[model samples]
Target: MSFETALKTAQDDIQATLTDLLVAFDGPVGDAMRYATGGGKRLRGFLVLETSALLDVPRERALRAAAAIEAVHAYSLIHDDLPCMDDDNLRRGQPTVHRKWNEATAVLAGDALQSAAFEWLAAPLTHPDASVRAELVLTLARDAGATGMVWGQALDMAAESAEDPLTLEQITELQRLKTGRLLEWPCRAGAILGQADPVHLLRYAADIGLAFQIADDLLDVEGEAATVGKAVGKDADAGKATFVSLMGADAARDRAHALVKSAQDVLLPFGTRAATLAAVARYVVTRDK
Candidate 1:
């Protein structure tokens, strides 16, 4: 199937599973869950499924992993949109979790979503090795937690008052830690689930992860808030380290294209099996939002 078709199918499965899971809870907890997961594009989940498919893992297995990743991503978004963080009033073209509900509810909801992600991963699946599942859990936690995304956020905030302007290298390092690590985890976890070679998988994961961030930086410059579903130009306004801030807009676009090409090159070893993922890399660079 085409990447778009596969992405939509995986997204539908994730939404359905999320809905089923959320149905068991009621009141504020349920409301927070729905608010967080109800309307995003499901990019991380789509990556999990697509990467798994490329490595020939079963659809059912991919779906389970995708659901878990989506939960973590939703939780992150909830926290990121808090008044203390991005303070975003809008998300996915709707009120942010904090805006829709009370701040306390939003915080608790984010906590719940984070917990639920590991719970989903721990559940029984076709992968019989409990150890492997545990490792996947650990990998995701590290990537999404203090050592990775969270660290990146802290650094980003620090960079705001930095006396020296951020260089391209510094920007790349920050993006890798903050945004790229989470994107990389999905593909690496899928590789583990599919029992692929660790070396090849890590290489592919690193390339695509960096590519994803470059695309994100490019989008921030050119994308609209209405289309992107988040605050636009926040990077420049905040003086955060960004490719576009270091390089001109056209140069940043060129860099994004180069990264996408590099990602596709890394996937070439998988040949035809990697086509969808390769397409996704291109799509990441070219997408308007």
Candidate 2:
């Protein structure tokens, strides 16, 4: 199937699973849940499914994990747009969770969504392997928590000072932790679920994670807010560190190309099974949104 078709299928599955889980909650929790989960590219979830497919893991078996990753992603976006953070009023072309609802509701909603991700992952899988489930939950937590994405956020916030202008290496490192970790985790989790070789899984995760970040940087430079569904030029306006900021736009584009090539190279061993993922890496940099 085409990457777009595959992405849509994965997104539909994630939305269905998230809806079921959200319905169990009540009040502002439910509203926040709906708002946060409503619209997204579902990139993280797509990574899970694509990686699982490459490793021969059944799509049905990987659905819960995909949904869990998306839950965490949505929660992060909600919190990231809060007044204390980026303070953006728009996301996916709509008012942010905090703006749509009260601040407390948005905060609680983000917290609830984060907690729900772990709960979903920890729930029983059909394989009945307690060890596997535990590992999955742990992997997601480490990637989403302070040691990973959160660390990246802290670094990003800290780098906002004019005197603290980031080097190219520092910008890359920040993206790896902040934006790339979550993308990497889903692929790694899918590989683990499929019982693939650990070494190969790690390599795939690293490549895709880096590729995802490069694409994001490229998008920030060239994309439109109407299509991208997030504020553009905010990076420059905020004096934030970014690949585009460190390298000129042309250099950043070239770097993104290299990352995509590296990502595809790592997946060569998986042959045609990894075609979708390879395409996705290219699409990531090439896409306007």
| Candidate models: Cα lDDT each | 0.80, 0.82
Query: What TM-score quantifies how close candidate 1 is to the native fold?
Result: 0.94
Of candidate 2, the 10-residue stretch with the lowest lDDT total is: 123-132
lDDT of 1 by residue, 1-289 (tens): 8877877887789888778767767889778887788867777778888788877788887777777778888888889888887789988888888898889998999898888878877777736789878878889999998899899888877777789878888878888888888788888788888887656656666776777787788778788988987778887787676777778778877877787788788887789988888888887777766
Model 1 ranges off by over 4 Å: none
lDDT of 2: 0.82
For model 2 the TM-score comes to 0.95
Off by over 4 Å in 2: none
For residues 1-289, write the lDDT of model 2, one tens digit per residue: 8888887888898888778778889998788888888868888888888888877777776888888888899899888999998899999889999998978888899899898888888888623677778888888899999999999999988887548689888887988899888988888888788877656656766766776676677677778999988888887777777777777788877877887888888889888888998887887777777
Clashes of each: 0, 0
